[model samples]
Target chain A: MNNNILEDLELFNEIIKEFLNEEKTTPASKFISPENIMKEIDLKLDKHPLDNEKYKKLLKQLINSTPKSSSKHFFNQLYGGRHSKAVLGDLLAVILNTSMATFKIAGPQVIVEKTILETISNLVGYSNESGGTFPTGGSMSNFMSVVMARDKIDLSINKRGMSKTLIAYTSDCSHYSIAKNASFAGIGRENVRYILSNNRGQIDIISLEKEIKKDIDRGLTPFYLNATAGTTVLGAFDPVKKLVNICKRYKIWLHLDGAFGGSVIFSKNLKNLVEGIENVDSFCFNAHKTLGAPLSTSVLLVKKKKYLYKSFDNDAQYLYQTHNKDY
Target chain B: MNNNILEDLELFNEIIKEFLNEEKTTPASKFISPENIMKEIDLKLDKHPLDNEKYKKLLKQLINSTPKSSSKHFFNQLYGGRHSKAVLGDLLAVILNTSMATFKIAGPQVIVEKTILETISNLVGYSNESGGTFPTGGSMSNFMSVVMARDKIDLSINKRGMSKTLIAYTSDCSHYSIAKNASFAGIGRENVRYILSNNRGQIDIISLEKEIKKDIDRGLTPFYLNATAGTTVLGAFDPVKKLVNICKRYKIWLHLDGAFGGSVIFSKNLKNLVEGIENVDSFCFNAHKTLGAPLSTSVLLVKKKKYLYKSFDNDAQYLYQTHNKDY
Candidate 1:
């Protein structure tokens, strides 16, 4: 058993060294011949175990064929690059393999996540009352914001579902996640008014207010406004300050979908991109994007901590023991 | 930089060796004095880098102090122990750090996940059209199943937001996630009729049918039925075959939350526990529980692929640039 464990570690170390060196020259796999590889690798699980030598060879082949996302040359999407500390932190997390649902299971990891959220919340100019949690991805983060907005609009929505025709406003140039999120929130995709954007792809503030006004005039409830900080296409920062006035006037739950461009809060020079960010009810940004963390490290911060409890808090007697509630 | 990387690797190697040794004897964390550890670790982010020796010292302290989930003595939770291959796969995933949302970005990883889903679906007697995805956890998996069932009952629910009074059924004895998931799907905690379980913690099929019948008479739409393959507290398997008869009679979508003991499918001796499991509309299990994989390795498989598309699929032109239609 010890020999097997050592063999696996030695194999991993060798692979790590080879991967780091090769990634410099090859970021994307040379060719993605799926059919050919499927035939060669034989991913099917048989009843009996294969020879250790064959298994090791197969592992190496699989590793070599997979795309190298850590390399600097890999720029296929918004999230790229890697940081050693972040990698180390995630590796340790996997080794520990604790569930992050409750404080009892996650332990100090809960505080670690909370501390990071608190820091990001502070950077966004949120008050001490602000709090957040990490969702699975930017889409899930955005979806959670929509859910919070929906439930906040009508607390009974959690109990009775949507009783009114709810309207959400997003720019035409914003991430497509808004539409999907609206769908998830039971606010039809059609209800998401795609206000026209200007040449720069930022939501045209005038157009946004016009749509909100029209929705209200039509006897529809204008409940949510998703302003993009960095849109997927042009990476445009919306006029957050300008939008805040309309949100306040209409009692709209303002959510900043800063999933892409929200990282500018880290740069003292570029923080102005999301100026007046604190006024928004909730804000989300993917740490995996722009910040060189691993995938699925998105944070969702809300101004009033009560909203999170109001939206997501459900009683479970078994999981939340009294000893676990440090926060 | 090379020296730093190598030193980090060596430090990791030493830690892994020590952890493996200690795990044989000690499973649970010896102690958890968070406040004291917080002071010693100095988790506050400073303006400049701390001393290398101090940083390494802090990292080692953290590794030592964390709860040992992989240890043999740690039988406090459903997911314990670790497979070396699983660890290797997860570590490589962190290094690759690719988002699983789109096929274009994830490349072969997309196929890898899909293949796993396909394999699991086949094991559950799902046809070629059956499909699934990896949610953040078993909770998320259960939530997805509810959403799919909701949407399937009234295709308009996705767009119109639960026009009908929808009701869901789950065993009295099951994972606490069901209540949270019910609230998440806008079905309300009140709407989830927890049918009483027998002495073995199996759902009372007669009681479940009685509740479904009562709800139908009262104008409530019986949309979903969640049966537990393994109850968290007792590891009880619900009478899935009996539940399926009622589900089919009422045209309700049946879901098997096998989050705890779903691996019985692999055991010829234990497979009888979940007999007639293939008839359920959807099923989910945590590989982390029985297979000794890492946490968050839950699988949710549906009888029909369309429900996955109906609930979760949305257009993201910027990210999902073709080549990922396996689902």
Candidate 2:
């Protein structure tokens, strides 16, 4: 097995070097249709393992045919291009293959994740009482915020079903995950009020306040207000400072979805994009987007750390052997 | 940037070669206390980038101190030891760095994921209507099942809040994610009835039926029945064949969580462990667990593919640029 790993790594080096060279010249690899995919590359998994030579050849073909998102010409989504250092870190993670759920099992790797969360928390101007976790993606991060908000507004909602018509607010310009998350959280898609956005794609505060007042008139309990740090289409940052006052007036949990442009916090000039981030109840930003980290490196931070534990904590004797809080 | 990537790859090769040698000699990496982690390795992230030499040295120190999960002597989690081929594939994925959300962006990679899902669907005896998606992990897979079941039982549950008193049944020995998912789905954790397990660690069917009947008698709806393929502690397979009939009589959605040992279906000798799996509403297993792939390669398959779309299909014009169904 050791020899096999070394030999494969050698093959990987050769193929990646060739692929990188091609990326420099062509940038975008030739796109193969779905129907012609099987002909272009052998993707079949068989009962028996193939020889090293055959396996390496097939792998080279597959890698050559894959889309070159790292190429300079490729610009389809929010994430593009690979950072060399970040890629190296990801490759090491694959080699280590450790689960970060428990401290005893993951060891220093847990600290590695914690350091990232802590740094991001501080960058958002959160106090020592703040805490965060890396969810799977931007969608999951948004979903976690909704769940936490729902539980915080009505503690019995987790143990007992929602007794009141709980409402949530987000701009129409926000990511589509808000509606999906609303349905997933059993709040119902109809319960989510999508306030209209202005021409610049920022949330219309007047319209938002009107909708909240309307819901309140109907005897509905409004809980969460999802502000967008970076709207998906226009790349607009909502008026966070203005929205903070509105959220406070309504006593709503304010969550900022910065999946598209949250890395502005790292930039001196762009920091003003999310000026009132410190006052928000929770904030999430995808490191993979602007930071050039690997895909799905989303960070979710909560002002008061206990909400994360309250919403996600579940006791399993077999898995969580240790009783440490940090883990 | 190209030169930097090549240099980093070279550094990666050297460090990995040394790491592999250490694994062969001493499989378990040295453990460092959380308190001493900062002193042991330079984990701090700063504003300025370090020089290549210093950066590489720090990376080497960090990787050396990290837990050796892939080593032969490591027996901490169910996922131990790494497949060299899978590692190669993961490294290639990192290099490609494509988002798998849409066809235009992902291209042939979509076909690769489809092939794996199709094969798994067939292995579980799913018909042409069957389909699957690679969720982030086993916990997310189970959560999807709950959400799907919730939406399927009452179609209005998605657009409107859950109006009925819906109850779900699971074994006491099942994964802890069941309760967490229930709370996330707004089903209420108390609504998930934990049927006691027998001495063999399989769910007691008699108690399960009694709970179902009692829920129905109290004007409550029994919507989901989660049967464990392999109980986390004892590795016991529940009587799936018998539970199918009970689910059918109650019209409950039967979901099999094979996160721990669902790969038994791949073994001809052990295939009988998950007998009558074809009748299940949904099934999920972790390829990363028994299959020796990367950490979070979980596959969720449904008997009727439309349920997946019904629960998770949120249209984003900016994302799904193409209208093809296969994407």
Candidate 3:
């Protein structure tokens, strides 16, 4: 090993020891205000470089001050805890510094990601025609699903700019990303119909079907419907079976925003939460949540592989010259 | 340090040493076929668990076969090299695993990302009104810029699907992501007018203006124009000052696709390449490129902060309860 790496390894060891032992034990550290932490540490970058001793001290300070999301006491965020294996995988990826845009540059790393997506697709009961991608987070995954539905509804939307008042339906209790994703897809926030939820905070199928018919009666297109596997507050799973039926009847593209609770697919007992997930056009879940992976390990699986290409595939000659069909 | 972490650290060091000493010194390793690598190691995940001894050995084999992009001989991709500090930062980020979405959850880490973005924004000569985000990659950054421009042209596009024939312009030699972004923004791929380039691979300003005028005469709304800071093939810098004038006259949103070459903002000698970048509505560049950060450290800056909110902001009550204006 190089001398510099040895020194870094030692320093990192010290930092990790402190983070795990000192920070992880305290609940008060989890609520440290950003302003309060900034007062204690100089985060401001200056013109001159700090000496080795000072740099090490600053790094230690940063590790000390940063919120301890991996700690047992840290529970402010939707994603908590960390897996050593997943962290090792993430660290190796950083050291390799490869982009997953193409197979030529990424090599086996592409297969690693593909394997994970494939496993999740199979768990969701999708067949060989299904595929997925690891978006940055749950929001991007949800947003991409909306884009695919929009394009699928009208292939001309990509060319002509919105010509119709297309409506999207979601449980009023679903994650806020649904409305945000609708906005990103050029489907206005007003157009995203927030159907009334039951006492369980799950989407009321009666309200959803009624709203779909209401939109159709108003001469507007009812194009998309979202079913949440785990809601933000109540952790309720929408009636995917009933929603799938409504989607089939109205020809609306059905999507399951399983970003929070979709990991239930891994459990034989809990898989019933999203029983009709196989019928949905697209499904997404974050491995960071429920499962103990690193944050942002979001997976978006589509029933039809064609939607993945139609939504995101762009021909960049310089980057994708290898163009293998297997990729 | 924990016993498990110490063991894993030792294993990681061995893998890194082998990668640097053996893999980094050769060119053939850079071109290792995916199939060949698969033959050397098992990638498929099975239900059975491997013992610690077997698991560690398998991991070593996997690491040995994986392509080492950090190697000096590997230069097939646009991003090359790795900064030790960046790698260290990324490793720490993985261990902490904090989401960048909100201040409450992210805490001090949010400030770190914000500080980096603020520094880059100032480097591009953006004012107090300027704001930025670290998108997942060059394409998402470019796509976000298109979304901003689309919304700026007509806020109603988000509410009602495409009703206008809005036209966007970019040099024929620009990055492929621009055309893809247009399609994503519901501005059809056919509508993205590819202005002919000069022999130097720079946008022909005359052809651009003529195309803009022609599109206007044909009753198409000329709303957006992208000036490439570095053409993909020839590395040509477009005449930003000239394009800015046409954009101002036509009331079009001017975006600088500096994904490859925007790092020049840090070089006094080469900053002249994008001299008129300050006038553009938005600019993007990847720190993973010339600056040698980890892969996907792309930066996107917009002239006005409202456009960022208009394009992306969606309210989620559970997540953004501490709605701080600083973000």
Model number with the top TM-score = 2
Query: What DockQ does each listed candidate score?
Result: 0.51, 0.67, 0.54
* Residue lDDT tens for model 2, A25-113: 87776878877888878887777878877877877777777778777677766865667878888888888888887887888888888
Task: Give per-residue lDDT, candidate 2, residue B109.
Answer: 79
TM-score each candidate: 0.95, 0.97, 0.95
Q: Please state the i-RMS of candidate 1.
A: 2.8
Better of 2 and 3 by lDDT: 2
Model 3 over residues A1-327: C-alpha lDDT tens digits?
122544665566677767666753564454566667668777776667677788888887777766666656776646657666666777777777776766766677777887778877887888989988888888888888988999899887866656677889888888887776666666777888989999999888888888888889999998888889988788899989988888999999999988889889999999998998888999999889877778778889999989888867776766576636775
Interface RMSD, all candidates in order, equals: 2.8, 2.0, 2.9
Task: Give per-residue lDDT, candidate 2, residue B234.
Answer: 89
Where model 3 places Cα greater than 4 Å from the true spot, the runs are A1-9, A27-38, B1-6, B27-38
After superposition, which runs of candidate 2 have C-alpha atoms over 4 Å from their true positions?
A: A1-3, B1-3
Candidate 1's C-alpha runs over 4 A off are A1-5, A324-327, B1-7, B24-28, B324-327
Each prediction's Cα lDDT score? 0.79, 0.87, 0.79
Single out the weakest 10-residue window by summed lDDT for candidate 1 chain B. B1-10
